[model samples]
Target: MIGKLGATTVAILLSGSVMAAAAERVEVFSTSGCGCCIGWIRHLEEAGFEVTNENLAMADLYAKKTGAGLKPGQTSCHTGFVGGYVVEGHVPATQVKRLLAEKPDAVGITVPDMPAGSPGMGESDEPYEVLLVARDGSTSVFARYPLAEDASR
Candidate 1:
């Protein structure tokens, strides 16, 4: 009975961790004139993220992205911080949740260049990749999109 109880408790804790990640608080920095950034924030909110949007001037927003260690090629209109990870550009909320759950040993993930089919940009036949940025600024393909199913949406 004690062993069964222990197992159940562990399962509960694991499930709770996933729930926490899904509902994590995200802080976003973007320019006041960016409608796309607002759309991205709405995407996060709809996905259960607690979003705090801080609209800065373009210069200040650029500084925040640079300070977060995002290179020119890795940048987008908005930047987000969550669970100590820097989320750049139009990264989907599912990838953000996965990052929090996996707790990778890196900076964060980025969509880069604002792909047309990305969450904020709406649907398209064009595909895009989400890159996981390392501490040294190198990136790897973390996720790819415009799958057969996704392209329809």
Candidate 2:
């Protein structure tokens, strides 16, 4: 009986740690004129993230601060900072959650050239790739999602 109680305690502690780690807050920087950015913010909030939205004229500055880069023609509507990770464009909340959970050795994530169904685009049924952007401005494919994959779906 004592052994069983000890095991239960350990399991409870492990579950608490996982829940605490997953309940991280996110900060999003976006232009006020972009409606899609707002939609993305909503997406994050719905995904159990405490999101704070900041409308700024110099989003590039925020991007640089968070170690996110913008490639010409690949730039999207907004940028986000979550768990020391940078997220660009309309990346899905699930991918962001995965990044935080995995804690990759890169700077952050990006989805260049915003797709229609990405988070915040208001169309959550499009396939897209979240690219892992490194500090040196190099990037690679991080995660892929099909259309209809959203925070709720």
Candidate 3:
């Protein structure tokens, strides 16, 4: 009985460690002066993602480094990287998880133009779409969210 109990305990511990390692933390890059960016980081943290915020001036350069082609009117207050994907603007945490799980061919997700009801934007509840931006400066509809509704659903 003692040996069996010890084996069970070891199995449980190993499973817990594996679960923790599966959800890797995310890193976010945003300008120091942007308040909404901070809010977005908080949203990710609340969703169980470990977030690292880097405040820098050359956001355009950062975007380029992450394979996010800087396009006119596509830039936002912040950008993030997770599981080898670039997350731009107020992308919902659930969408980030989906990107990691689905492992699409594209670069990552984006929510252009601080739209209302996004993760950080403190505007009225309005519908928005998260675009899947590819490395070749192409984008397509990835996900859409309704007004005042959470993207996780």
Q: Provide TM-scores for the models.
A: 0.83, 0.74, 0.77
The residue-by-residue lDDT of candidate 3 on 105-134, one tens digit each, is 877788988988788887555778999987
Clashing pairs in 1: none
Per-residue lDDT of 78 in model 1 = 91
Candidate 3 overall lDDT versus native: 0.78
At residue 24, what lDDT does model 2 achieve?
Answer: 77
Task: Sort every candidate by TM-score, greatest first.
Answer: 1, 3, 2
Q: Which runs in model 3 stand beyond 4 Å of their true positions?
A: 1-23, 59-67, 147-153
TM-score of 1: 0.83
Better of 2 and 3 by lDDT: 3
Residue 76's C-alpha lDDT in candidate 3? 73
- Go through the candidates in order and give each one's C-alpha lDDT: 0.87, 0.75, 0.78
Best-matching candidate per TM-score: 1
Model 1 C-alpha lDDT per residue in residues 13-110, reported as the tens digit of each score: 88998877655999999888788888899998888889999989999999998898888899999999998999999998888988998999999999
C-alpha RMSD for every candidate: 3.6, 3.9, 3.6
lDDT of 2 at 102: 90
